[model samples]
Target: MATNTTTKKPAAAALAETAEARPERATRRAPAVVGPPLGEGQEPVTVTLSHHHRIDGTDYTPGAEITVSPDYARGLRGQGFVART
Candidate 1:
């Protein structure tokens, strides 16, 4: 039997990809169509809550929806919240 293998990017590459995709890097600083600019320096951030059928390492089910500000999300990003998927 033959084994299949493929080259994978490192964790740093994943992080870089995420950083590149951040809203802060928008090419044009356009105005927001709904309620102030998303993630603007001033004003509270808004996020939609979603319930997923599954989650990792957590005993809760079906899942939980949480709304967090951009500021709060930054903290969560470092604490494995972004890894939940």
Candidate 2:
């Protein structure tokens, strides 16, 4: 009878090998807003909120009007957060 001999790799070494064999995963980023490009020197627009929301670290209640860049206001409008009026 012949005795069988085998060597087992350490758990950490196996994990490192597995990780290196795998391809690097791409980093996630915020989705880009799809709309017209912002114009230079474009006047800001005032929009009234239809719901309580926060902007630029400032809290705003429903019906509160805040002036922001036209492009930003357009985004809010599209989301139904800003009143149409």
Candidate 3:
């Protein structure tokens, strides 16, 4: 039997030519999904907040303050945030 002298084989050559291609993106994605979109005049409110303040580490009150979107403060309401007076 004759020994194969070719170091570059078809399989090895194809493997060398293969490359990982990435698709080009058109436009940038919108903001990360903070939550669902609000109505014409509404905002988003983060429900189920943490009692302990991450800033001061103090036990805050439920009625004292709550995190909400600016639009929500106007009229937009999140999934479960309720407008308070």
Best by lDDT: 2
Kindly list the per-residue Cα lDDT of model 1 for residues 1-85, writing each as its tens digit: 9876977889999999998887685584322322223365544443332233222333222233434456665654565444355
| Per-candidate RMSD, Å | 16.5, 9.0, 11.4
Give one digit per residue, the lDDT tens place, for model 2 in 1-85: 9876988899999999999999999995322322244479787677788998866455779997777768888789889999866
The TM-score between candidate 3 and the true structure equals 0.23
Q: How do the candidates rank by lDDT, highest first?
A: 2, 1, 3
Candidate 3: segments with Cα more than 4 A from true spot: 1-19, 23-36, 49-85
Q: What is the overall TM-score of model 1 with all chains considered together? A: 0.26
Model 1 weakest lDDT span, ten residues long: 29-38
List candidate 2 stretches off by more than 4 Å: 1-39
Candidates in order, TM-scores: namely: 0.26, 0.52, 0.23
Clashing pairs in 2: none
In the range 1-85, model 3's lDDT, one tens digit per residue, is 9998987659866765663344555795423223335556655554333233232233434443544455643332333334344
What TM-score does candidate 2 get on C-alpha atoms? 0.52
Report the Cα lDDT for candidate 1.
Answer: 0.46
